[model samples]
Target: MSDDDAERPLKRHKPQHEHQETNVTEIERSPDFWFDDGNIVLQAGPTQFRVAKSMLSRHSSVFRDMFSLPNPTSESTVEGCPVVVLAGDTNTDWKHLLAVMYPAICYDLTKPNIMTVISVLRLSKKYDLPAFRKESIRRLRGDLPSKLEDFRKLPVAGWLYLGEVSDVQLSRTIALAKELCLWSILPAAFYGLIESIFNHDGSYRPVGLSLADEISLLKGYARLTRLNTEAPNRAWLEAESPCVPCDDCLFRTLCRSRCASLRSTLQAQQAGPGAVFSGWDENWSDEFCGPCIKAAKEAYNDKQLEIWKQLPSFFGLPDWEELRKMDLDAGE
Candidate 1:
């Protein structure tokens, strides 16, 4: 075989819905190393060691955390040690630079560790450190349906970004990811969400829930008070459930959309009778607010049965043709 052909690895066949495999080992052991004066030193082979540190304090927290430590002593064991030796590559300076740089780029000190992991995931893939890469991938996949939206916004900076993935695979994996995680990725997430809702499942192509469905569910909950007289006061908004709860809330914009009336109410306090536009960008509503729902419903209505005429054909949902045939048979 040619050198190029020889270097090409065999493609592993994957089963549908099978989660991608990652290589990770439990952190049962650690590395023996020392950090001093913004530099890291580690023993390599006999008679030699490696060292690295951040070029700047703002560059990486990993280096800062490591540098604050003293060298490992003779009494120290691998357990509870925080350092990891990168396998294969032997340049200590480069390794030190990575230790310092990776953390700086991936982590925002103010955010939780989970958020930091999202940024480090691709970096893990780059170093080809099987354990780190595997663990990072698993963390992301395990968080799955919860991290779906977050996955969308994540820098597609690693092996996963390569075009080897299929539409079916991406759709299936993402359909099950976290909505908030998926929301972070925006257009990519939007397309993936759409694909997931329209995926085929062998003999029975399933119809998955769309963004519209989620909005409809929210609206249904909001309208519940009007339906049942004795139903406990089920206000959608409450002191417990404010307009925006978390920093990554999926419905923050939808729930707290700008109101003309609220603007007018505030304007009443101003000296001039002239009104200031609600200052709410219409795009926000078109993209994430309730108006999108209204617009989609209107468009769908305009398309009539033509759009849905194939819904049954594509997804086997109540098969309109089969239903008509059944009716004809009954008439006979």
Candidate 2:
């Protein structure tokens, strides 16, 4: 995507499935978050939750303000309680929010439920529920952590648990992060998407992302591929570096034999920025001379670290510190 592509029309939004139309006389009750003695009815889509207004007002300033507004003398009621049909929200979104907020059946955030995190995050933002929003962001950061060390611990498919998320959902995560101004997660999110493409065959299209984001990913992917191609394989893209000074008679051959032997493995192992080269074995050091061993361990890892540090810039994002600062300022 480019600035000039602003006029380029994208495919029309085609939903996989439409929301089931509920009959006016057949509104369904929520299995959870439905209090029998509740004084308010919150409906979204087809589902309705009877809940205590005091509790909602206590947690959400938006809700408090909305409730404090003067109601019409002829306001409609459901079961004698005021009905607040929240527009532009899905039943799932309301369900997740209420599940997390409800005292008796508080939803556990420890579970790896990205849907819960996302849904709660959206409603929490809209309702100004600071605590829930903060916790939801924490959960998102846990999955797409900023640190390279933490990032390496994730699986080969690059993000999400087995069968827990698909590439389409991951793409949606990118869109959500951008929309919410959660800039800190962008680097790792993009890296995860690209890494999945190379190593896991993940195929992401510009479904919900903007043209700028699409362009950013394309350029970043090209740059990452170049980096991966040159990564520590042939003396790390600096075969005759004056820094190493391995041209001496003793250091002659530059241990090229040992370094060359490992090129195929190194090339195959490296996917992009977070490439930890887990394929490397310490036992392989026996094949290297002293200087060559240092180069192998230190120089190679330094390159990957460099890539990790550049992750944000690769996607036209501010560096990690600036992005982190933005997130902090937003919270404030």
User: How close to the true structure is residue 318 of candidate 1, measured as C-alpha lDDT?
Assistant: 39
In order, the Cα lDDT scores of the candidates are 0.32, 0.66
Output the lDDT of residue 193, model 2: 66
For each candidate, what TM-score against the reference?
A: 0.23, 0.74
Per-residue lDDT value at 135 in model 1: 49
| Winner by TM-score | 2
Task: Give the Cα error of residue 271 in candidate 1, in Å.
Answer: 57
Model 2: lDDT equals 0.66
Segments in model 2 whose C-alpha atoms lie over 4 Å from true places: 1-27, 67-72, 103-110, 153-163, 199-211, 232-256, 264-286, 289-295, 328-331
- Once model 1 is optimally superposed onto the true structure by TM-score, how far is the C-alpha of residue 201 displaced, in angstroms? 8.8
179-278 in candidate 1: lDDT tens per residue?
Answer: 2122222223223333333222212133344555445323332232122221111112223442222344456544355333333333344221001101
